[model samples]
Target: MIRLMQHADIHSVFNIEQQVQSHPWSLKQFAEAVDSYQCTVIEQQGQLVGFCILQPVLDEANLLLMAVAPDQQGNGLGYQLLEHSIEQLPNQPVQIFLEVRESNTAAIRLYEKAGFHQIDVRKNYYPNPDGTREHAVIMVKACSDDFAALFSSP
Candidate 1:
């Protein structure tokens, strides 16, 4: 099931974030996201398995963060979480943007499959645990006329 994130979900979501991201968002960040962003979580068998955070301003939206539990990845949960979050944006966004670490090819491919294309690269945008920095690939997608229809019905 996919639904709006609740305060109770923070710990579960943060666990996945820590497990899957080299640089994870802090608990305070998650608290703020739950308070301010369009945060959605996906549950499987009553366990939170994935989540996506988005920020919408007028006709544009930014995918702030997204993640799936390591054991649950490669099973389409991330894609589902992403598409659902986009469709649920408060405004009918004409454009959506997101940035991903250059080394995360899986996420890049997932975004590409969802119609997002790379528009630019931010040099050394993300810091690694090893003290190295990596580029961030900026991707954008035009939310055309059939933006909602383009996604398969759940």
Candidate 2:
């Protein structure tokens, strides 16, 4: 089940974040996102398994952060969270944007499967644990009249 994130879920969300991210968002960041953005958490067997954060502005939306527990990887939870996040936008955004680490092919494939295409790349956009920086692949999906239909296919 995917639902709006609550204050109590921050710690569980943060745990997944730490497990999946090289440089994870701080607990305070999760708290602020739950309070300020459209955040959603996915549960399985009544336990939090994944979460996504989106920020909508006018006709556009940004997928700020998303993560699934390492143990839960390879499941369709991330895709479900992404699709639901778009569907729940306050006013169906004309476009959606997100940035992913260049090395994160799994996430890139998932975004592409959801109809997002690369638009640009930001150099040294993400810090690495090895004292280096990683590039971020910027992607966007234009929401046309048939945007919702994109996800209807198997």
Candidate 3:
């Protein structure tokens, strides 16, 4: 189920963050983010499977963070979470933006499949676990009336 993230969900959210992200956010960081940003989690059978964090303004949003349990990736949970996040955006001329590590092909593919298009490249934006640097691929999806209608259609 896709729902608003609660304080209790931060523990599981932080666990996934540590397991999947090279530079994981600290528990306090997650707590602070949840306090400020819009957070959503996918829970199933009473366990949190994935989560996404966003900073939204009037008509656009920045997808600051998203992660799934390492063991649960490639099971469509990530796509569902992404779709749900977009679907729940505030009613307006919505656009969502995000950055993905260049080496993260799986995540890039998921974003592309959900209709995001690359806009620019931030050189050496992400640090690798092996003491190297990776570029961040910035992507955005503009959800104007036609775009929203495209997804809402049968």
Better of 2 and 3 by lDDT: 2
Q: After superposition, how far is residue 116 of candidate 1 from its true place, in Å?
A: 0.3
Ranking by lDDT: 2, 1, 3
lDDT of 1 at 140: 97
Q: So what's the TM-score on candidate 2?
A: 0.92
How many times do residue backbones clash in model 3?
0
- Residue 44 alpha-carbon offset, candidate 1, angstroms: 0.4
* TM-score between model 1 and native: 0.92
Candidate 3, which segments miss by more than 4 Å at Cα?
146-154
- Give lDDT for model 1: 0.91
Q: How displaced is residue 5 in candidate 3, in Å?
A: 0.5
What Cα-based lDDT does every candidate model obtain? 0.91, 0.91, 0.87
lDDT of 1 by residue, 14-121 (tens): 999999887799999999999998999999999999999998876688999999988999999989889888888876687999999998999999999999999999
Score every model by TM-score: 0.92, 0.92, 0.89
